[model samples]
Target chain A: MVSQLTRNERQLALVILSALALCGLAMAAIGRDDLIGGHGAFILLASLGMGFVVTSGYYHAEPSDERLAHYYDDPSKVGIVLAMIWVVFGLFIGDWVAWLLVYPEMTFDGGWASFGRLRPIHTTAVIFGFGGNALIATSFHVLQRTSRARLPDQLSPWFVLLGYNLFCLLAVTGYSMGLTQSKEYAEPEWYADIWLVIVWVTYFVLYLRTLARRKEPHIYVANWYYMAFILVVAVLHIVNNLAVPVSIAHAKSYSLFSGVQDAMTQWWYGHNAVAFFLTAGFLGMMYYYLPKKAGRPIFSYRMSIISFWGITFMYMWAGSHHLHYTALPQWVQTLGVTFSVMLLVPSWASAGNALLTLNGAWHKVRDDATLRFMMVAAIFYGLSTFEGSFMAIRPVNALSHYTDWTVGHVHAGALGWVALITFGSFYSVVPWLWKRERMYSAKLVELHFWLALAGTIIYVFAMWNSGIIQGLMWRTYNDSGTLAYSFVDSLIAMRPYYIARAIGGLLFLIGAAVGFYNIWMTARGALEESPTNADRPAAVPVAARTIEAGE
Target chain B: MDIDHNIAVVVAKSFGLFYLIALSIGVLVYVYWPSNGKRFDDAAKNVIHDEDAPWH
Candidate 1:
């Protein structure tokens, strides 16, 4: 990867790394009395390690000018590999936590091994660590293809990818060390959030620059979704994380918003973290990759517009749904519920548009496990969105809010919609990226499909059963009007379901491991070489015919 | 800036209702404008490419 850059670019990379190391050193020196010092040491060591690697490759001959004729994909390649690593770590930890729910003794005496710390680690690792990397990687690939332009520069993309991963690294490590703002999904403290903002701004700028250089007359819908995801997330992160740190050295900070306002601000940030980050970003992926894989265009350009804009406009109001029945004003909760319900139109429009786009290629979906991952993903997307809209209603939220049903609802989207689609896109793109004819084993892809599907079903079902039971038990009244069931009774009831959920998670983790192996082997040229021209994006001459969504 | 609760409620609800309705109508009109079929077709076909490279 370093050899692809010119000597000057390498020097620039070295300088950037050195600057980062200096920042790390400053943090370590100033915060030596606090936990931030340990994070500082980690950042310093990571930067130095990367700098040395760059130094080793500095003297290699620069890539030919021909490099300019190709998309800058080195960053995307690295992003995919990093995503796979995080998925495994996240899934393993998730299952470990699930098992701990059943057997409370399944933990070390260490504070980090406690359920509270490990739970956030699992959430952050999978959502931000795995899901974030996939979005960044695929967004780069899709942006180039749809725009028909190379990225404006190489170094910036690398900076965005590496920098974002560093944020993820800091977050996972910091959580274990008891560093947090205690803001649900927005858990990372002030400094790490600041670093993410810097990285994110660079990403947004890079995207816009590439879009400005597009050969197409109109911006693709996928780019629109990506732009929304990038822009709104910045707004959410900045506004919600407005805090005054107790000290630069200390990891503790007081939020700018206090009381009910803090609760409102948090969900506004939290739910949109779901909206823009999870939904919009992956919808963008589906818009591009799903159609391309099926050799179809979008089902309706008209519906794409409706869905894209409708989602952007409506999702902001729905955040208050997360704050339902809380100290938040009644009107705000009502507004959230109304918008949450209204969001179903756009959500289903996108989902239906994707499914309809697959009409001509249903046979291909049937035969191809890669396409099946996406097909199920769209179904899950539709299913989960409907479920989400319903769950946001006041009566429903009364039962589901604190229950495991909420967990089931989230995984329906996270595992079934987000992850399945990511894996699907990866299966298709990995072989293409490596310029291979196909994966190392089609059978393994098929195996992976079943494993992931079965795992998701089991996990979601187990949660649903436990969640509803827990909700019912909590609300049940005896003749005297007191609750019929104790919290411990509910806990005892959840034991079997917890074990099932862990087993399900284990299967999902195993599937990801198989996927990584297949991807690795393909990248290493383990497969017998075949004419990969048919699957190549360069195969079809566009001037001869435009591929419609369906006949 | 210092509107009463009733005024604030009316303002918020009215603006939200009008905004969503206007957006829906505007999008429907633009998408269904009969003359833009070819353009939408072209946009949808953006990924059906001869080369995904920087196009030498």
Candidate 2:
């Protein structure tokens, strides 16, 4: 049975075994007296046991001869499953964090489970674990389909999938143990960051290698977006995470930048993390899935090209807006605001292009819950980008800064746009990957859609009200010119909203669970009846094809 | 000394501003160039054309 395993699978097994042995040695060296060290050791042992069980099962299974002739989708399959698990875990942690705000006693002695330690865990888990995995899965699916080429080799995809997840594991565990470089988004200390760099560079090379082997004469626009995401993120991660560790064995590290320079560098990384990680990569998913689901050509290919360049160029300059009212040069703030405002043009162009692609497909969107998800995602993309530009203006930033308003704004994008589009794409891709005849439950898909939409609306509006009131109270003055509201007054006011926010988060979590269940049942072939035309080629726009042939 | 500092700031800002402008315009020209229209159109249709069997 082991002999039947591919070279890639065998290599992965070796890597896991060596890692487990190293973890054993490290555990012995660190001593189990310290609580944090004990926890780390326990996690390592558990992971090692799980790896052995899963690998043994995988190695013993026979690869179907029929599947070998088809597209390479196993890595994508692994990614999708991991993504679902992480989304649930991330959302659950996020809800706990929200509840911790209203119920301060929830911390209960303030160790690993305290809000400060767990907050980064929630953010990193969702953004990197959930969103990152979805991007990788969908990018592989889109790249292979769009490029009309096989992935260069099977080994690299597995390497990227397993390697990247290992980095996430180290990051989450280290954070819980109080290991960090004190950066916002790039908080993972030097060693973890370096590990990610290696994984990401391999991903970049694999993408380029596959593109070079394309059967199509031209590289697709979606691949271009994914490429930008991969390339720019690598650059940002490396620069922002430059730090010196106290010792090779210790988790402590000091960043290269200090004081105001550190603040500037952190936000620069934070803002671009959103741009490339959240926006560009997801845009890649949108370009492929939205048009395919709609059964239409993209509204304007030229507009896509123009906006791609525009977004890539404009977003780099907008990070400084995050440092408004700080010691960072006023001129730098001005530049940030200017470019952020300019960003709306390209942002809206992509959004409008997507909506216009649905011109004749409104009926399909109505009938198909997945299309509805993508359509709403496109609308939210427009709304969020507009709101972002408006907030970046200095006066608005002054009002919105350090308030729940910014939190509301981030969720409006993250929850409303990113998660929805990902869910939509997952619905379309999962059935195709398993060669299933539609999903096990279409009704459940519709149910999940409303749950998600309602949850986001409730979450965003609550935060907005909380933020505005907070901002106003902080600035209000008495007739004698003294401040009117004490700091405690604002805190008191936020209590009700925090409760409301937690309820919103709970709803989103329930919706995500519904999605996971539906996909799971679909994969297990729980449907009563299979559709006859399940394997039919998706309809492509005739006009676009004719134009292409003529060219 | 103040005059020299002012000159330095002006030189840096102007150079940065003009460089961005030229880059943007260059991108616009390259995208819209007539010769590349066929390529762009074909690229757009890649997803549609390869819908049947992506691996093939």
Candidate 3:
């Protein structure tokens, strides 16, 4: 029995159980009264959960004998763990914030004051804490395999991991305590910003060093995407977050740009933060993992190059589209629209490449859960891109800009494209990382996929319908040219969508839980597999490498 | 239609052609570049002690 569990597995399972116990005890303690200062309590719990996962043995690899050691462990399990934690943390933060609103007397500044404090805490942890961790962990696995390079320095990998989580801590904690620059996406106060800058610089250097030491002659297409993401994001972060803190301890700061200039800068950073951080980085995952899962060579390497360059050039100019109809200069608005429309080709190219990679392996798409997740993601990527291009049109923007349609569009990208791809990548990765011959239950995985997919469709459709109705209502000219529907009526129409959205979220939560359990059990099964590619082996020399004849 | 429509159609067709040509060039280059059975004396000499070595 003892031989069945590795040193890492034993520790991880125990920590998770202990955290569960702590959460249960806290809930019991606050039985009659809501937890006082729920913000701090949830923060502490969420931080502890994240810290435990990061430091736990599962997050690490022992040195392998290869020149560049393989992961020799499953990163997919790490991603599943992180994603599950994100969902839990997100739900708790949302509920706790809502509760604070309902029972204002429960804490300082009551419910209304709590949102300004905790919303950033919730957003940062979910975006950077959860999504960022998935990106880094998956990136490390993909980069290593594609480049055929053993990771450069073990210490730097850990630095990237620990430094990122620490940065997340500083950002969220600062946000909760009323420390911010009030720049929507770049809200972290000066000290936290400094911490992130250090973390991100280390990431850039580490990524470059590994690529430099690659065993392969050509840098794989995925590496290019990831490198662009890391480099461009660093530029975006520094430029948008330019502010002087009142005092490091005081948590107050003012942005350098003011008035219309400031608004332009914020959206520039905000929209591209999605472009570089979320879209490009996750696209890197899709490119590598989808083909790898389908067990096929990439359909067209040439298309990949075109798409990469196309997306990069087009997306940067499209940020001004977010400020359409504002005083952002007419020429700038025109530029945004022009580039935004141009973005469709590259986005579709990437999606087409993925689907085509699975051309012969279409049977796997039906049978394998991981491929299903990836293929669904490709479909959603196509859908969301079409929606995004349409939204960027000036007349369409006039209707959808301030409505729930934008929210629906964003979630389609997040839930359908990003989350689905991340999920598929994890499912494929965890078993290999854990050294399991197969997943614990393919049936459960299929069930999870359907539930999550159904949830997403329901969520998106409800919001889309409501958004159009609201938009029409808001813009309608009556016989006398008065507005047809009151703003309150539009708000009332949104109630059904909100309820549907919540239900959809709950279904996703359930599906994620199922995935988490399946991964945990799979990890248990592979606990005894001896770590093979250790000793941090150097990458094999390229020319000396023998090519196997094609199948 | 109008002149603008004609221009748009022409531009689209040209770009589409360019994309295909680029892909074809890449494929041809990959195929023709020696992966085996090429031992030109100067190239063979450089293989042993090439200063611009691919990373070891």
Candidate 4:
């Protein structure tokens, strides 16, 4: 990847790494007695490691300027690999946590390996590591095509991708070390937050710079969603992370808000993280890859417009629903539920738009596992949004909050919608990026689709059953109004479901493993029939040529 | 309950109502505008072309 850069950009990479290395060294020195110090050392070592990598490849002949005619895709390629690695890491941790619930003695005497610490590791790795990387990679691919432009510069794209990974690395490692602000999604302490701010600003600027160079007259719908994801996430992160660190040497910080206000702020950030980061960004990927693979135009451009604005206007207000039945004031909770219910309109609009776009492509969806992955994803998106709005109602939340039902809902979206869409997009992209006619093994893709579908079904159903049973057991009354079951009774009843959930997660993990292998083999040209032609990009699509002529 | 707190809640609620109404109108106008059909259709058709190359 470094060899693709001009010599000057290579030097710029070295300089950037060196500068970060200095900052890391300063941190290591100042915080030597604290967790911050450990993270500092990790940063320093990692930067030095990347610098060595750059220098090792520094002597390669400079890439020719003719490369400017093509889109810059090296960063996207690297980002995809990193995303796959993180997906495996994250899913493995998640299944481990599931099994730990079934068998409580599995942790090695608790401490860093305890459920509390490991849970965040699982969340961060999958959400920020896997999901974030996939979004960044596909955004680059989608943005360039939709905008009809090359990225403004080669070096900044690398800086954004690598620098974002560094932040994810810091966050996961920080969590494992028992260092956190105890916030749900925004758990990373002050330094990691500051670093992310820098990386994200670069990403936003890079995206806009590319868009500014577009030959297309109208910006695409996918770009709109990607832009919202980038912009809204920045706002959410900065606002929720408003804190005063104890000192430069310490990893701890005090939030600016306290009590109910803090709770409100955190959920506001948390739920919108779900909205922009997970939904909007992946929606961007779906809007591009699904239509492309199906060989169809989006069903309704006007509906896309309405859904985009409706989602934008509605999701911010729905966050308060998470604080329902708490001390967040009754009106705020009511406001949240109202918007949460209304959010169904836009959410279903986007989902229906995706499915409707496949009107003429049902045959492909039936025969092609890649399109099936996206079809199932749109269905799951519709299902989960309906379930979410239902659960947001205060009376419903009363039964569902703090139960595995919420966990079930989340996994429905995560596994069924988010992971499925990502796999579909990756399958479509990997072959294209690697200049292959098709994947290394279509049978493996078929196997993966079934495995993913079955796993999601089994996992979600188990959680739902266990959750409702537990809820009813707690709320049940004996004669004369005494509680019927102890909490331990509920736990005992949940054991079988926990075991089932673990197995379901294991199947999902194996499917992801299969996907990564297929992707890797395709990249290696394992299935390429014509090696010489494989080196060239696909014969340009016919429609593209006609479109170019028209333009 | 304090009167001031109640008043504040009422004001916020009213503002939210107005904001929602305005947002609904704005989105509908953008989606249904007479002249936007052609541009949006062109974009929907052409957005994913030139997958491996730029439009030049």
Q: Highest lDDT: which candidate?
A: 4
Give candidate 1 misplaced runs (Cα > 4 Å).
A528-551, B1-10
What's the true lDDT of residue A358 in model 1? Answer: 96
In terms of docking quality, model 3 is: incorrect
Instruction: Give the TM-score (vs. native) of candidate 1.
Output: 0.94
Worst 10 residues of 4 chain B by lDDT: B47-56
Clashing pairs for model 4 are: none
For each candidate, what's the DockQ? 0.58, 0.55, 0.05, 0.67
User: Which of candidates 1 and 2 reaches a greater TM-score?
Assistant: 1
Candidate with the larger lDDT of 2 and 3 = 2
Q: How well is each residue in A219-282 modelled by candidate 2, as lDDT tens digits?
A: 7788889999999999999999888876655667788899878887888888999999999999
lDDT (10s digit) by residue, model 3, range B1-56: 56664574567458845875676566455534565213222221221231221234
Best by DockQ: 4
RMSD of 3: 12.9
Worst 10 residues of 3 chain A by lDDT: A31-40
Q: In candidate 3, what are the lDDT values of residues A472-491, reduced to their tens digit?
A: 88998889988888998887
